[model samples]
Target: MLYSAKDYQRVRKEKEELDLGRSQFRRDFARLLHSPAFRRLQGKTQLFPGHESDFFRNRLTHSLEVAQIAKGLAQQINKRTPAFKRRSIDLDLVEFAGLAHDLGHPPFGHNGEHALDDCMKKYGGFEGNAQTLRILSRVEKKIQAAIGPSDDICGITPEGIDRRLGLNLTYRSLAAVLKYDNPIPLRRKKDTPLEKGYYESERELVEKIKAHVGVPTASTKFKTVECQIMDIADDIAYSTYDLEDAMKGGFSHPMQLLAKVGDESLLTKLHEKVAKEVPKVTPDEVFAALTDLFMLNGADTPALEQYTTSKMLASDAKMRSEFTSELIGRFMRGVSVTHGTGADIKFSKVEVAREIRIKIESLKHLNFLLMIMSPRLKVVEYRGYEVVKTIFETLDSEEGHLLLPDDLQVMFGRLTDTDSKKRLICDFVAGMTDRYAVEFYSRLRESGASIFKPI
Candidate 1:
């Protein structure tokens, strides 16, 4: 509410200025919306690969859905809570956060992400959230300065030879997507999974963002008010829409999920995952929540029980649609907002009701166990992992720089440092679409090596 002009300050001065009478955040949204990185999301997978069916959610569609949900949440808070009427959340900022949140995700979804992280473990760990920051702050290619000559991105002083300011987005807009505050370590702790933090390359830029937003540099969590809404909106979309996609894919429906196909171990695994998301959640509670959620016959519990043997009735399309819509509406109502104590209203904390939280966690983990962790999808994911790494390795070979495009080749030629050069390779591989990655891998490794057409 107490924002200053610094909140709208760009990391670097614009190379070209055009004032068409748009708000600063509006221009931020336009820059992201029109970028090639955002357009590539149409080719990227969300939960199921786009090849699975035309109806499945992709990254672009998912991000759009998140934006809509986030705007709804912000509007709800602004109108419903009296505290917000005085200092309301900016709808544009929250919507921009929602739309731009997942732009850094690599091809083939998390499968490709894990593969790239494994490839770059020695240089810098790869993460979706972290990549989002990198794409906005450094990678998307909006502004480039005279190399090593003068001012830095934050108008400080240039350090790296590649003096590019991605979209030159505002500090507040950047902070809205700054989900994790920690910097990803070069080498992850032994026996731990990939870390979820920004790269060391963007540390100074992050410091500038936090300082401008009034967040302490020493704070562990740097999530902003807009970020909180976007995070919850992301969860809500993942929980409901993925379930909707699952039903359409015929992977799981009410009857199938309810029965668990009589697999005791599968049921136990689902409960374990649910417990991780919602601590101390019992198996009974998980099933109870699912039962309540998937009861398809509106709130008519007896009717659903009466037709336990009828799979057609359970899988009705109209009923499933109504169920997901109801679930989403209820969860949206669960979000609550509060300001921090003291003279500074610096941060706003958001809390969702435990009931909705349980349902969301339950449904999300259901998809995780039955779909993501399933053997059917695992085979394809394993192949994706191989494709990603093999591509990175081939491109990082002695003469690999020759394979890069003209623009990239120019940058590659400028840098003498090996780490910086290898990072350029990582960035190239990390930006491929699923089909593009496969095609490129086939040309490089398989029988179809091509020199006739441009890659």
Candidate 2:
């Protein structure tokens, strides 16, 4: 076996019963599925809310899809590689990683993430990956504490040590969740708001995962194979699923989006317009210079074999580029969600192959340009940050912090500096649902919204 039960560290004390040769990692993955933090994902955003439309996916749905895809990929690779087949990667571990990957996302999609990152910058800083670690190891602790001897409650399990606690997952499951290697408070200080990995609040959990895996600190810099599976599953889902959502929203037709690619005049105009607004670039000339030097100059490369061989193959290289561009354009128009049987699973390998991953990523960069960093989005961001900031202001106060459970409140008091306080504040904010955040803001702001009302 690639990894034995001993290769994993169980967070909760276990009696070492049920020596199921499937390995302890599989059991750990199962525990995560039953955790409250994982359940919270059902309410969080994937691209948009579930109420927006019937076709789009939320984080919970997305996580499930990623798990499926990761399992398929792991199985495929294991079957293809002799060594992997002999002592193969565990599918359950990868699936669990994919499922629990986004357990830390704040409400309102990436908007909430950006808002919290900005709000907590003075504290310890917030990134989704870091926040995921925080959720599994800490915020979930609060949820456990809230349960408080309530055996009558639904969804409560007392399988291991610390009955009311975080997902006490095995180390293998946790290791698969750590996609990026960079530590919190990023090595190079920047204002981009996105970090390569988790926060300082999760140092202990990180250490535990690493120690259990027997990975050297330096070797832990990249993702494990399971993590890679999860990451690729994420990319596949985002590239294809987001495209479907964008198409459903009617921002731009799939075909129309494709036509814009490699069109010199259009590229020139897009560069001019986008450059003026993009934070990373100063002017159209600079944008054009950068694009040509990097993307455009390299665009005419040979088509990947996958494109040539797919059932819905693009016959010409130019057409292939156009199809890829259209796919991205279709995805970028916008996103919404609705309730349905969840049967839409069509995906294009030509769109997400290694050769096209970077290109697709470049187009999704518009997510930064048109949606995330756009001024209109910034207005929403401003409001979100303000809401979070005000919540922090209230919660960090003597009385507000006291309202929390004794342990968290004590942790808040024990924190000595602005950074620590901010992290505590993020812990509070990150745990909120969309309606909860709005309600909390209203209550704190005295917005005349009824405190007795349940959303």
Among these predicted structures, which one has the highest lDDT?
1
| Candidate 2 C-alpha lDDT tens digits along 23-95 | 5666667667777767777776565456667766778888997788778776766666555656566777878
**CA RMSD of all predictions:** 3.5, 10.7
Stretches of model 2 off by over 4 angstroms after superposition: 19-23, 142-165, 186-193, 216-220, 262-353, 366-382, 402-421, 446-449, 453-455
The weakest ten consecutive residues by lDDT in model 2 span 339-348
Score each candidate by Cα lDDT: 0.81, 0.58
Q: What residue pairs are clashing in model 2?
A: 53-337, 53-338, 54-338, 54-339, 123-419, 130-198, 258-326
Give the best candidate by TM-score. 1
Candidate 1, residue 223: lDDT = 79
Query: How does model 2 fare in lDDT?
Result: 0.58
